[model samples]
Target: MPAPSFMGIYPPDSVQEVHQSLPLDPLGPGAADLLAGDVEYRLHYLLQEAKKFMVHGKRTTLMPEDIEHAMEALNIEPVIVPPRPLPQAPFLAVPIPSGTSGAQQQLYTVVDDEIDFATYLKEPLPPALANSAGVKWKAHWLAVEGVQPAIPENPAPSSRAGPSRLPAPTTGAASLRPSAKQHLTTELQLYFSRLTAALIPTLAQLPNLPGNSAPGAPQYSFPDAERHRLAALASVRSDAAVAGVLAYLVRWVAESINKTLMGATGTIGCLIDVVEAILDNDVLFVEPYLHQFLGPLLSILLTVPLGPHPTPSGMSPSPFELRTRAADVLAKLVNLYANGYPGLVPRLLSTLKKALTASPFPSPLGAEHPPAGRYEGAVLGIGACGVHAVREAVWGTNGDGLGAINDLIGLLYPGEGRKNKAPLVRATMKALLLLTVPKPEGVTAPAPDAAAVAEAFGPHFVRAFEKRPWQAQELMRLRNGGGAAEAEVDAAGEEDDEMEEVQA
Candidate 1:
């Protein structure tokens, strides 16, 4: 037996324990910094090999066998992992031990694993699930049923210079096989089926909540089946086998919120972030399966119950996770704007506008509640992005960007409700105050109109401006002077022209 090389100042006992736990524990003493580091290295290697396999097979799962092969090629047996039983059985659970000494373990139980694949093919999936997480089942079910899309004799790439090869259109029951693709399809279908079955009751009970007296709340309804479907879809996305599918699912969610749901901006932003994670990250690939996965998921986000009110207090919603997701999505969109997707600017701002207007700001009373906080922060961040950066990226000047900033200010300082909007108003105003500091890029400053600026911000707007003395002075100067600094260059050009004429 190869004695595990322990590169540390650890006691011999600790080394023995680590070795006992993981023989291929590559992160011994000086081996690597931690277990995470080893996992990262392994992931990098697996991704590299998976990319290669993708070239040959379009898409393939990087199983333990693939990792083992890569390890052998690298001459590093220390990284090879022995296979454990895969999560195959339905109605099973994965119990994670709790940190507390005697705390109850967390269980991820699968309620219904078995499904008659043939029977599902014969009957249409529930319309709600079909519309929302529908695309997934259709595509995967077709694959399992061994269907193939008709291949054109003269297929062409969508772009002239893009990859010329076309993906085989997936169709009927005949497409299912014993191969990896078929296996992925079956697993996904089973997962979605189980999840949809579990979600029905939770969604059904939400609408009838007593506090949902707001008109929008009752209108916001989703089939309980759809939530489980999304959960299952998320699980599939997390899987290394079909990473590409995640982006598509996210896009679907976004599209559904905007289209089917009619401007459920809060939920849509969350979906956008999911897509961004797939697109912006250098470490991962968004696979083709996503197109199939997302088309239906979009339908679901549209139907999922979402409204302006904060969720009831002590509902125990996951605020941190929700915030992180929203931030991730917003960051990606902002990055795209920064990196030169100028065309996306108008849409980004519009999306932010819809989200902000849909919810009550500073929240009514239970604003600190998990659901409310998540919505408020998400909305505020989008508004901030719109006012602070997206405008600068698109128009590239104070004059051009000011309209966008003004829009945010208007939302923050609505009449009569000025008291309710106080916190949001102050936050937005402060952000705008910072933005007003002229960083005059290439464009000549527009003569500042105090009245216009004040009007844009409403009555409290002047107060926000009062705090920034220098910016106010600059604005005054721009207002007093007819020609911005832009005129000076023309004066100099005229002088040069005269000199050249005299010399000639």
Candidate 2:
């Protein structure tokens, strides 16, 4: 049967007429909704090239200029917007810029986007204002539907508009909005997922490491509480017995559970309670056993879905954090699979794209540069991996994984020039190489449903290569520099020196 159609869904005759006048690609608008958040930047860039095909008064491919204008209208600052206060609950319910009430009767409005800490403090307080917890409260009664009403005589505080007068509570999850709660929960879940995915393959190889059957080292079990203990003992003895495998597996299981329980409010709360329990446990040195899992956790996290909403603090996880963890995971993953498991490459590439583009992150002034704390390499690394991965994966898949790769390219290469460059540029480069290489036996093809990757990426093929041409060139230079010969010489010299020193 044909797909169900609603007459109301069709554009009116007038709209169709206008469309006929414009030089528009039939597919662009249908695919436009996928251009949410930062994806808009990439779309804007694509639009610039597309406009050349458009006729006057006719819709054409979206051009960079068109995208730039759209971005402006959407309040996406090309230069990173500085940190601003989040509109709190009660404050959000009222109109901003408590308008002028004196003689002029001309209505003025406040745009929260225009109000920052400095200007807000400088503005005179409107009449009948209330202040609490360092946040000022006021209301402007503007005309609605051509009707204006005077303030009621001596109205109760709740009757007044603007920041609610109720005392703000300090703790408990109740303080967060439903959206914020889910967003934070999802972010946390994503973090654990990436880590779990990264550790799996390497951990799988651990059980077979040479000298794994050392004294006092207990064998690993498929399903047993004592497995972690056995793994911990192996790590302490620095034995090859357990490898880092079991530790990673434990982490994978834990993160997988977290992912499954994410939306189960009761289950999620319980899982968090469990995490808290682990955090509070002083007797168990969880970090040692816990740390190995970070790889897979990072991998899964990078692949997990994220929300576009902001946290209450007006801050998201720092870009620094995003870049560093992403880079570390990419680097570790490639190293683990370089000659051993190239099939793991596509999976890693898939994870990289998800982490960088799925959720829009805060873009503050300093966000342009590397973030100041840990995980700084995350954005740059992820971007680097994405750019190259998309190009290579698309090619490797016989132009199949192109959808995912392309989507990722849109994410990593949002605009022109280095100043606006995504932070995890290096990681993107590494992932690209990995994605381009053919998968080894036993590894499957890139996920088939990743069509969005190619659609998002296909248009920017040339631009993606141009964005970082030098990096590709340098990689070739390193490969041809008798790479393995130099390494072997260095290894032999180091061994000789060690033996000479012992004889002396």
Q: Which regions of candidate 1 fall more than 4 Å away from where they truly are?
A: 1-184, 191-201, 204-239, 255-283, 286-328, 336-342, 346-458, 462-504
- The lDDT of each candidate is 0.42, 0.39
Tens digits of lDDT, candidate 2, 229-301: 3343333334232232334334434554334321222222222223333333344444444434335335323
- Clashes in each model (backbone N, CA, C under 3 Å)? 19, 65
Give the candidate number with the greatest lDDT: 1
Candidate 2, poorest ten consecutive residues by summed lDDT: 163-172
For model 2, the stretches where C-alpha displacement exceeds 4 angstroms are 1-253, 256-309, 312-320, 323-327, 330-334, 337-391, 394-419, 423-504
Candidate 2: count the clashes.
65
Displacement of residue 231 (Cα, Å) in model 1 is 10
lDDT of 1 by residue, 226-301 (tens): 4543454464435553343344334434443434222222333334434544455444553433343233332332
